[model samples]
Target: MATLVLAACGTDAAAPADRDDVGARVFAANCATCHGPDLGGTDRGPPLLHEYYLPDHHPDVVFATAIANGVQAHHWDFGPMPAIGGLSDDEVAAVVAHVRDEQRRAGLME
Candidate 1:
């Protein structure tokens, strides 16, 4: 018997890569629904752009974990952040970057 090898499909089959744009889109899609378009917090979500949270402390990691596993971590004190398992790691990276950038611009970075 002879073996059969299958070649991979065209690159078009893969999803487009746009970390920054995707991050913004993702935030607008999933987060903005609760966090607001400016990330200024909403009636449901807590403020993530001010002194309430410190980005330098471990924001990127914390944000990633919270998104991946839901906000059952210590953030419940503020409000329950629903889990967004639909967001990929890269999307999370973009959100974190956007938050960091905003924090820096606001002089809230520690």
Candidate 2:
């Protein structure tokens, strides 16, 4: 289970309905094991729903970069994140969109 943290701005902009679905599917297949299906913290990874993941600290691009290059452990004790392979650029974007949408729904973002 790898960690995939997605972030969102405080703006009201929303992801498209279709992209949201695709992103959710992609997330379930690749990220849910660690990140949880609801972006909640699992034993294996930190929660994206927390304030630490606010867009001010981690913008949407951070998610794409993390998935592409992985991240070192800095905020949590879970250990470094490993790069997620085999995702296309569009899939990455879709995952970001999904994460942003979930963040908004959880009130972590505007």
Candidate 3:
């Protein structure tokens, strides 16, 4: 399979085997468009950095389901989040990890 390693900041994101930050790469490739580079809400979707996603409020598993099955618009007017395709389980986990880490950094969770 031919995979492209597209990078924006890091200088060592050339070889896929050399990647140490899989979550960041995955987010950039998938969720960055709607979630923004910083995970802040954009015109398309709500920010993953919001307090609504606290570990107690929305568990990590919820993210996994949403990614696979898509989510309805309950909090914003962005409408339903259609299921994103072509990602492996590990890749989905990586994206979840990335979002959770950013949420913690933003003080949305303890």
Give the candidate number with the greatest TM-score. Answer: 2
Ranking of all candidate structures by their lDDT, best first = 2, 3, 1
lDDT of 1: 0.61
Candidate 2 wrongly placed segments (more than 4 Å): 1-15
Model 3, 38-98: lDDT tens per residue?
9987899888888787778777677877887898988789999888789776666667767
Kindly list the per-residue Cα lDDT of model 1 for residues 76-97, writing each as its tens digit.
Answer: 3556676786665556666666
Steric clash pairs (candidate 3)? none
Order of candidate numbers by TM-score, starting with the best: 2, 3, 1
Q: RMSD to the native, candidate 1? A: 9.8
Query: Model 1 compared with the native: what TM-score?
Result: 0.70
Listing every candidate in turn, what is its Cα RMSD in Å to the true structure after a full C-alpha superposition? 9.8, 5.7, 7.8
Give the winner by TM-score: 1 or 3: 3
Error of 3 at 38 (Å): 0.3
Q: Give lDDT per model, in order.
A: 0.61, 0.80, 0.71
lDDT winner between candidates 2 and 3: 2
Specify the poorest-scoring 10-residue window by lDDT in model 2.
1-10
For model 2, residues 5-90, the per-residue Cα lDDT tens digits are 33232222455776688789999999999999889979999998888887799877777888888999789999998999998766
